[model samples]
Structures are given as structure tokens and as C-alpha cells.
Target: MTDVEAQQAHWAATFAAHPEMYGGQPSAPGAYAVELFVREGCRTVLELGAGQGRDTLAFLRAGLRVTALDYAAEALAGIEQSAGADAERLATVAADVRRPLPLPDASVDAVYSHMLLNMALTTPELEALAAEIRRVLRPGGLHVYTVRHTGDAHCGAGTALGDGMFENGGFVVHFFDRALVDRLATGCTLLDLTPFEEGDLPRRLWRVTLRREGP
Candidate 1:
């Protein structure tokens, strides 16, 4: 199989193995980010790579309408099972975010992504995804995201080579430092980026909140 197809298969297995990870019941940082967004008044949200609706459920429970987007059918099934009738509050779609975001311009009030950008794209693909995000988000819409921040220690199935690249589950993961992210968000107005500890791990994380330029 091609790289994209192999990557998709990997995530499908990962999500299937751990459905609860994406079912709105995260233990720490993930939960914190989701709670903060809704508390800050993100009413209509779209989550890219929303595996099994974890953050999506959090938003819905907080009275925010959500659209959960993931490419894995198994992941969506798990989300549906966990959400039950409340699932109606969510619109689940299967699409690759690296391509054109399957929505009209300025369609969503906010975009929330977690751990999605780290694995799914090359530098060029990331640029395209950022552009798509800019296109789909309403003027002044918020973009809340967390990506793998640069630090020490090996985690996941990946071993760090001499450089910043890692091989986790046989897929290459590019860890981003703060400067890298700032460059990527050049077009968007950055609101805030706070670094925080994740769980009992020594690794660092960036909680970024950006806004699409207002009309």
C-alpha cells in the first residue's frame, strides 16, 4: 500500500484498539484544552481528526454544536456508539483534512485539532491544511490546537534519530518547536500559546489559540 493508505490503516487499528482515548474522557491535557475552548465561548466547533469523538462530546456536553471529522469508519462507529442519541448534536464526516476541507468557506465558527497535525502531513501538506482551515473558518473564528512540541525523552513507538524526526509505529513524526509553529500560523492572528506538562511525562506541549482575521 501507499504511504497514505498505510497511515490510515495504522490509525484505524489504533482507534479501534483504544476508542475511549477519543471519547471525551481524557485524563489531563487533552481534557483541559477541550474544556477551555467551550468555556471561552466557541459555540460551533469543528474537530479535525476527531478520533471517536472525545473532544466533540465535551463540546456538546458544554452546549456547543460540534462536527467531528475523522477518516476512520471504525473510529466513527465507536463515536456513534458512545454518543447515543446525543450523537445528533454531532455531524460526523469521513474525509482527509490534508485535502480540501470538505466544507464551504467560512463554514465553521471554530476549528479544534489534537495530535492530528503531527503525523498526517509533510511541510507542504501542513501549509495546505492551514490554508484550508483559513478558508473554512469564519472571519474571527478561533483555532485551538495542540501539536507535538520539541523536547527530550523517547515516547510512543518512535525512536529519535540524531535530528528532530521520530519513527513511531513505523511512521515518521516531525516534532515542532515554537518557532516552527509560529511560522506555520503566519497568516492567522495568534491569540496565545502556553506551554504545559502532559501527564506524568517529561515531554512538553503547546496549547495554541489563533484567530482568523476578522472582516
Candidate 2:
């Protein structure tokens, strides 16, 4: 398999192995941060690399329209299952963020991702994803995301897969430093950035919120 295909397979297996690794509860710091920063509206929201529909379901529950995109078929399937066949508010697409996402330009009111940017990708690939994100967001749109901080203990502890790739139980993670993320998101205005702890977990993480540059 190619590099992207290999990465996709790894995540597919990871999701299948531990479907509940992220916990069934709707409580990730990134999700909470996005909801807090972005307003609730009738317009649509796009969530890239959505895994198991955690953020998508949460937003749908809050009465927001959401389109959840991921490259792995298993991930999208799991999201549908989690939605229990009644979640008409959520739409699913199996697509990669590094390439052209399925949506058209300026089609979304907001874009949100969680632990999506740092996974098994080089700086160039991340930059491409950032550009695609910029293309799809409408003017004044908000972007919220969290990246695995490079110094997090679970990274490179010999138990890790290799290089910047590591397995967090059922989820494979890619670690990043702040400088790298800023470089990837070169053209956007990083409105606010703050470090947050998840469920009192002992790890350093960042919540980054940005606005699309005005036309």
C-alpha cells in the first residue's frame, strides 16, 4: 500500500479494535472548546477526520448541521452506527484531507477537527490540508482544532509505532510542535491558542482556534 493508504489502514484497524477507546461519553476538550468558540446557527459545519462521530454527534445533538469527513470507511461506518440510523442531521463522506475534500469551496460556516492535524503526515501534507480547509470555509468562518503536543509523554516512549507515529490504545496519533502547526496554517489568523488538560489527564495539549483571512 502507499503511504496514505497504509496510514488509513492503521487507523481503520485501530478504530475497529477499540471502538470505545475515546469513551462513549461526549466529553473531549477539543469538542468542548469548539462549541464554546463557535456560535450555534442553522448553517452547516464541516468536521474533518471525524472519528466515530464523537464531535459530529455532539454537534448534531446541539442542533447544528454537520458534515463529518474521514478517509477510513470503518470510521464513517462507526459514526453512522453511533448515530443509530436516525441522525439525519449528520452526513458522512470517506475522503482524505490532504487531497480535495468532497465539499465545494466556501461551503461551510465553520470547520472543526480534533487530533486530526498531527497524524502520520509530513509538513507538506499538513500544509495541503490546511489550504483545503481554508478553501472550504466561508468568510468569517471559525476553525477549531487540537494537535498532540510534541512533548506529550505517550510520544516516542519506545512503545510508539515509530518516528512521530504512536498508538494511543486504538487510536494512532501524530505529534507536532507549535512552530510546525503555525507554519502549516501560514495564511490564517490564529485568533486564540490555549493549552488544556483532558479529563484531568496528565499531558500538555493545545486548543487552537483560527479565523479565515478576510476576502
Instruction: At residue 137, give the lDDT of candidate 1.
Output: 89
Backbone atom clashes (below 3 Å) for every candidate: 2, 0
- Whole-model lDDT values for every prediction: 0.74, 0.75
**Structural similarity to truth (TM-score) of each candidate:** 0.86, 0.84
lDDT of 2 by residue, 1-215 (tens): 76666778877787888988877666465456446644544367888888877778777766677888898877887788788644787789888776778789988888888877867776677778888888888877878888878777777654476546776654556777778768766667888888866645566678788888866
lDDT of 1: 0.74
Candidate 2 least-lDDT 10 residues? 33-42
What are the clashing pairs of model 2? none
Model 2 CA deviation exceeding 4 Å by range: 37-42, 84-86, 159-173, 199-203
Q: Which candidate has the highest lDDT of all?
A: 2
lDDT score of model 2?
Answer: 0.75
- Candidate 1's residue-wise lDDT over 49-143, tens digit each? 87767676777777777788888877777777777667778888899877798889998888988778777466777778888998888988888
